[model samples]
Target: MARGEELYITVPSMFRCPISLDVMKSPVSLSTGVTYDRSSIQQWLDSGHDTCPATNQPLLSKDYVPNLTLHRLINTWSHSSAASSSMHPLPPEITSGEIRQLVSGISRRPDAAGVDELEKIVRFASYCEENRRFIANLHDSIEVILRILIRDNERVEFLESAVRLLDLILLENGVRERIQRLIFKSDHEKCFDSFLSILKNGKLSSKVQSTRILELIASTNDSRQRTIGEKIEATLPVLVHLMRTETDKHLMEAILSCLISLSTSRSIKVQLVHLKLVPILSRILSDPETASPTAERAIKTLHLLSTVAEGRTAIAEDSGCAVAVLDKLMKVQRKAKEEGVALLWSMCCGHGDARVRERVGKENGVTKMLVVMQSEGDDRIVRRMCGDLVKVLRGIAMAESSSSYGQGGLGSLETKTTHIKPY
Candidate 1:
């Protein structure tokens, strides 16, 4: 067997860490008689949990001892298993020297040569987890790449390559925080402007990469999310434009995810409404073949948009938008159903527009599905909202019944006394 090459064997249950669920490299036993990977348990303890994760028993002592016997058993078993099989040698790890060479190459040559360097970095990072960790931890690795992006903001090919590399490596530990710190602390405007430039001018793949990066950054925390929303406010129009013009499912999904993350801000929500996001999302949702995740995101964006007056008006004003929202109620996914309920509630109740309520009431099986959703699921808010929606639909039914009676010259008493069941 090659030196230091791990055997790709199925781990025994006892060999797995309870916290991370991975094969433990350094097993330790706690006071509760539960064994865990030392790093996992230490991290859990560092995060301020005083109880054992597996048993939830109060930890009388925070200290742990190395599971020397268990560790020896695992190591012996691994070696024995390796001896019985023809083991394939793992790929060579990418080195900091190689990354430094690429960074220097990109700096010295910023044309096809630079793009070639970035392609190399991207290929290396994309190879495996070890390579990604190596590149991500190497000092100034991400910063150098971001600098290439900023310096060559006008070079489309280089920009695409750099953005692609960033997207690939940003998932590594501390890479996102490193980039976040670099962007916000130094060259904030230039970094974001480069992203904006990509959104506005780069090709479809590059735009997708940029949008994915935005989505990742937005997911870090609320403050950073709001900051990104404000910084990329200009790109909101660009994103909406892309959604309107592009038909690629991946690009569409990425843009929708970024928008949904940024839509938490009221100003951003209003800007999106003004940019006609409602109709765009409505059109996406109206399609039958739209992927479930995409449809759910579209519904969620619309649900957020419905929180504001302008958004509600925009959705209610669109002829097919309200129908699209109702369509999601019948979907099998609970999230879609939840967003659909919240959206319909926001429009019907927030606007108090009788026309919107009447339209929801008129849709087939909506009430039945809403009732089913309430009874089957444990989401109390949805149940309560469903109850309110049912009342509105019933009221709409009664109003229509009363109108029909009056038109037929039936007695006023019948019109006044009639009751309509939603089911």
Candidate 2:
């Protein structure tokens, strides 16, 4: 249409992907079901601009991220180059057969018990960012070193170096998960005690490094493998200390969830109550937005706490604990009905106190819980538990109804009505 139109060169089909050049790797799926290299194609599709480049037809299905080794290779190379400028780089890959090489390569002379070997081992652990085969080996190496550091007979000074190295290892996000998964069957207290010492260092910056420590400590799977006594005796104080000192949400979640899981311990239950964590938990329940998904983790932790005898005693001591957990049940009714229904169902644990029932019922918690209970027509467990919760609620309502009758029957009946009429 314009004088310059003929000057525009046509793009060649060879430039397109030979497999499907119309769109360059929308998902880039491999035969192994791994999808890779998204953005360029995904954004093109998301922009509502999909059409076959060669045929001019609408785009079809898109693919998911794939599990191909080449994809991992590409991602690894890209991140490695980018991470060169950082203090810590790529995280270690979880590998199976490299444990022996990792162990031997990092071993010190039998007499090298000084902090010098500790320093070299720590540095090797941190280089996991480079993520070569060495990266995997380094992770395995950390386990062996951790054993040496956590051994009760080891000099405490080298244990201190393990703390610093642990922080560097967690600089990568997935490292926390890897550590959480790996620390399951180890002498965790030694590691935790080491971390606590680092935390207590007066010279350490409380802002950034504290949060990383909290995350790893929180996600560590110590509970999954350790005895309940071991978990409380070894881990709770350290995590409690983290909760008391750290303010970042990720860290708070890790500490809180860990604490919640450990609430079975009479000691930690006493400590949380002694520290007045109930009001804090209550405030979080009232406003899940402070932590978003972390808030959800907190709520689940609270639910777990509610199941323990020590937890119950703690709740009894702090009225706010029951109030907070039930408050979520109330919120589920008014603001998030779907989630609320689930809470009520779970909370119908065959029993609750009068004060809790009253507070929750006054907050309109009963109506939602009743609806869920009424719908479980054939669930015997639900039926038994719901009946108990309903009894509690009805008793509260009857007590109110009788008091109202004493005050003024008809008018009170109108005001306290619980029935809903359908239009």
Candidate 3:
């Protein structure tokens, strides 16, 4: 493992927090005799839960007794010859005053040195998970980055660092809620327009970071859908453009992830279908080279889109959609399997035509359904749904066969499936 500038042999298991599964920097003992990181335990308790998250037992006291000895041991291990070579020690824990000073420095002069300090602060906070937790709710730091973004003569270097830092701050729930309100609560649509503009015209790194923040804002847990709806409408076209034009695998995954989150809402799903995203997603899913997260999010997005009538018809009319989904069944991750099957079921459900059924049978759709049912027995819903799909496919095949026999020729079943355009 690598720590900051040092190469380490290994991290001991005892140094890990049971709740977060991350290395504990500030070990603390709980009343239940289990030791945990102070922040992790404090957050767990702060959420109004009395039982331990790692062990469901109720706590006798909600106090976090600091384990000073273990803390010292971790400090020694961190500073010891785990460093293959001598390097600068880890930066001290950043204070609120120091952060304020850094922000002030940048505000005074948005030059190279100011940007350097900004990037340096961001880099230090990323050194360990604890640092990220510490900086997660830094509203002042976020405001400084925002100032950098809106400043005249915006430096690409500064913009990138500022956006990266903003992304890190939004990881905390309280920061997300506050930022959401600050941007969207006052009916200031231009603030959102800036995000779309950056996404369309910013540098590569800035574009990625812009998309990340836009995704967080769109996915905020607000009861008011009007703001989210507006954001989606403004951003959908740019998201489609990015998905098609981006060649970087990781960037594409992030874009698709945003799509998945946005498409979960019924209103946004309609806009996506109208924009004709079905075929693009289907082609991506069929490609063997697509990364797993991208494929999973694509398939899930398609599943949500299929819930609407336009979505189902769009998916079915495309020649590759059903075949693409079937190709991935029982071949990808578990959730992908479920999504693929669900989409196929939606496509074939109301299509009572002979040609569509025969096409499905010829495409090996029925055979794939059977294989998925067998492989996914542990999931009762998948098993039941796959069985129902096979039944429907067989019924279509039987009707097609009977019609062919009545015409007294096996060649009668060779009719091509017609694609009907949805109104």
Q: Give the lDDT of residue 253 in candidate 2.
A: 53
Pairs in steric clash, model 2: 17-21, 34-66, 34-67, 35-65, 35-66, 89-129, 90-129, 332-340
Per-candidate TM-score against the hidden true structure: 0.68, 0.53, 0.65
The lDDT ranking, best first, is 1, 3, 2
lDDT on C-alpha atoms for all candidate structures? 0.71, 0.47, 0.66
Q: Tens digits of per-residue lDDT for model 2 on 188-286?
A: 445555445544552233322433454444443545634424534454555556555656664565456446445554555666655656556666666
Candidate 3 per-residue lDDT over residues 140-169, each given as its tens digit: 555555655555555556656767667655
- Give lDDT: candidate 3, residue 342: 76
- TM-score, model 3 to reference: 0.65
Evaluate residue 182 in candidate 1 and report its C-alpha lDDT on the 0 to 100 scale: 70
Candidate 2 shows a clash count of 8
- What does candidate 1's lDDT look like per residue over 42-87, in tens digits? 6556434566777867689999999989887766665565632422
